[model samples]
Target: MSGPGTNGAAGAPLLSIEGLSAGFDGQSAPAVQGLTLSVKAGEIVALVGESGSGKSVTALSLLRLLPRSAWIRGRAEFVRESGEIVDLYSAPKGTMLSLRGADISMIFQEPMTSLNPVFTIGEQLTEGLRLSGATRGEARERGERALAEVGISEPGRRFSQYPHEFSGGMRQRVMIAMALLRSPRLLIADEPTTALDVTVQAQVLDLLASLRETRGLSILLITHDLGLVSRVADVAAVMFRGRLVEVGPVGEVFARPAHPYTRALLACAPRLGAPRKRLMSIADILAAGDGPFGRTGRSPWMPPVDGDSARGDGCVLEPVGPGHSVAVVEPGEIAAGAEPAT
Candidate 1:
């Protein structure tokens, strides 16, 4: 696999999103607003935030999986396996259908709900292949191999079982296997390990990492787990209330968080042997006013503003270091001054 931060070929991003926004009908504000991010081939970019921070919404928006009531606006350029650049937001329906499972696939957070209870594992696994014109026999063979590739023992036996017959981790492994069936170039894994135990979580993460190394896969891992981001992601993007607050290399962002929300998130993470203290909430961080957390004159959590007012009323990402940026209401504040401790 290519090194972290390096694209697979020619330094071109596999997926690039800019000024993306999504909002459901009747909602006064968008679930996601003017967000921009990119994923390079063979790299894992973690979208980390608290629940309802719009991370999953961002992923769903990319695939056009959101409900019809949801409206999306922005440019999302994707490099297909064929090297063709397609704007996902404007792609034809047929093109999206052809791309969904073949070029890009998604593993939803809950495999139990994602997998059909009545369908045999093998049948579900091969369904996509069959629809894509593969013969049943060929599809089944590939399905079994995929099961084996995901570390499942007795692939033949497991193929005949139902979703209820497998453990949570096993079901998740099956989901991963299904996602890999078409050898997608990009995998959107939304909280892939959320429902698993700690050990199972580690196994799944390791499996994802191994897949990237073996298949040169690019993954967009959406989760609230900072620890997981630190462990597996090459880049970390933090979100809050539907906006990107900070993004950078995982190590740099962790070592020097420039946004108040990012600092609050790191402080809230459970640490071993650290003195126990009441973890601060996002509201607390915002209400802290112009203290250490708010080195800038105003809090970054001010009301959202349009492009015309962004400079004075809203937050914009500012470069704090090479390839590292944090959102601040005033540019150059965090980039120039010392950041607060977590």
Candidate 2:
């Protein structure tokens, strides 16, 4: 396994997270607890949930990008140098510094914050490429190519333009270009298409798919849009609160959801072939039950009586269809999972 085969086998799963729980309060109960997920080479795994579900937190914890005050737990194994695993939580600062953009890169939700408003888009993009070992000239060349790859025309002049000069969609393309500057094996994209118009979003998604196919980059896409997730993800993980409620290949999960929470979520979405008389609303869920997860629902792990002091009727994640897992709990219990907000 020296060439393409080596890349396929060796470049597999740049990041793996197991039982990860992290938060700013450093409480025993993490904002997202007992989270287990992975990103494989050339694959897209979508992490979907409503607001406050800990999807973004999960990504931030992986890069150690959270504030110093926060406490992160669990083992994050980053594969590098052929079969090596590094614990991101307790790793030395040096390990973190090296891993940040080289081995695994991340694209945050907001381009304005991630990109320096003061610097021209070109300068910002060039800076990242340079930091990863590209010479200034080479970085410039790559930056231009990156912009073009992301569908930004006139990449050379745009390089000298600040973020303010670009439209929201253009800024997103710049962010994507910056993230793609290097041949990163894993990319954690937290709502990369947020705030973009529908047309722009479609373009960006297409660009992402093409880029992924060409480079075989593993992607962790965190978004609230189940439709978007279905478009890009090979597998989907649905979280509630801070727990994983269900996970499986995209098609199976969409076709026949086993978990009651899942059924409720899907019922909320507009089905192309089904009628749209009713939409699932959180308000309905809140009113129907005694707990935050809903009291009268058909699932377990519902929220506590007051949204605090959770009722521990933990549901076991059971397989429904092949390659699909759903948490099975008592009828009155709510699903204990984090909801990743937009």
Candidate 3:
């Protein structure tokens, strides 16, 4: 898998995953199993899943950023900025590190962990820029410009400040600035606006969309926020038990979801600032053979595949239309065909 597709700018997918499975330390079950998706050039693919659904892990594995204790397997094909295809799963360390923070950057959920408090924000930003071949003076100027581009105010003043000195939204802007310093071809933003207020969230989301369009940046956005995904993502993939339960164009999936799980997710959302009614929510842990998507692995935590589930009751994903895929419950199943496996 040295080179599988055209370069990132060649009007093709920049990243592709096939049969990917990842397991954390001390767990026999994979946090994610048999996951697959692709990010076309200048397109944003949202990996939407709740807590423990392996959304973040999937992103982390792409750059081989997962801990050594974690076990990872399967195909991870990527096109570099130079337009060479490579298998990210087994990429050489030197090559991977070179691409990281330069060709492809990630803005993780927690800013504090991603940024070093000891360093000034400007220093943190300039460091990456300079390392990527910009002169020190150029790095400083570019850093300020990037911050301003993300809608941060008083960019010059903020550039000299430490991470703690900035508000949450400002800090996130700085993170974006750092991520975009080298104008990476692919950007992986994991829960970029999780804790921000609504107004700022909207602004940040808009900035992301704008940047993607203007810079022609391919992106893989991992988040549990359906609202954010609905706002910025071009394509959507719903994951349950480490498998892609549904995937398609954002508009298509959002308006007419084919998977039972995705439909349930929409039903669970608070409507137009409406308050939620008390009800038993879906459980977090899903067992294989217990849902429509079957176990692609040998773990109980995986959703059941069609016709192969324990009770022979679960369903698997089937392609619904051209370029659109989703899971559906099969006919004549347990619960009298009242399939809970969506």
Q: Higher lDDT: candidate 2 or 3?
A: 3
| CA displacement after TM-score superposition, residue 5 of candidate 2 (Å) | 18
Ranking by TM-score: 1, 2, 3
Cα misplacement distance, residue 14 of candidate 2 (Å): 3.5
- Candidate 2, residues 1-342: lDDT per residue as tens digits? 012211334245667888887777646446777787777667778899888888988989998889877887789898875566888888899988887777788899876577777878888888866766788889888888888888888988887888889998888888877787777778888998978887887777777777777888778888887878767777789987788878887887888665555666776765568777475555454343332223324343444434452453355666766767765556535433322111
Runs in model 2 deviating more than 4 A are: 1-12, 26-29, 131-134, 270-300, 330-342
**What are the candidates' C-alpha RMSDs?**
4.5, 6.0, 6.3
Q: List the lowest-lDDT window of 10 residues for candidate 2.
A: 1-10
Candidate 3 at residue 279, lDDT? 29
C-alpha TM-scores of all predictions: 0.88, 0.83, 0.83
What residue pairs are clashing in model 3? 2-85, 3-85, 7-83, 289-304, 292-315, 293-304, 294-304, 294-305, 295-305
Rank candidates by lDDT, best first.
Answer: 1, 3, 2
> lDDT (CA) for every model shown?
0.81, 0.73, 0.74
Q: What is candidate 1's TM-score against the reference?
A: 0.88
Quote the positional error of residue 134 for candidate 2 in Å: 4.2
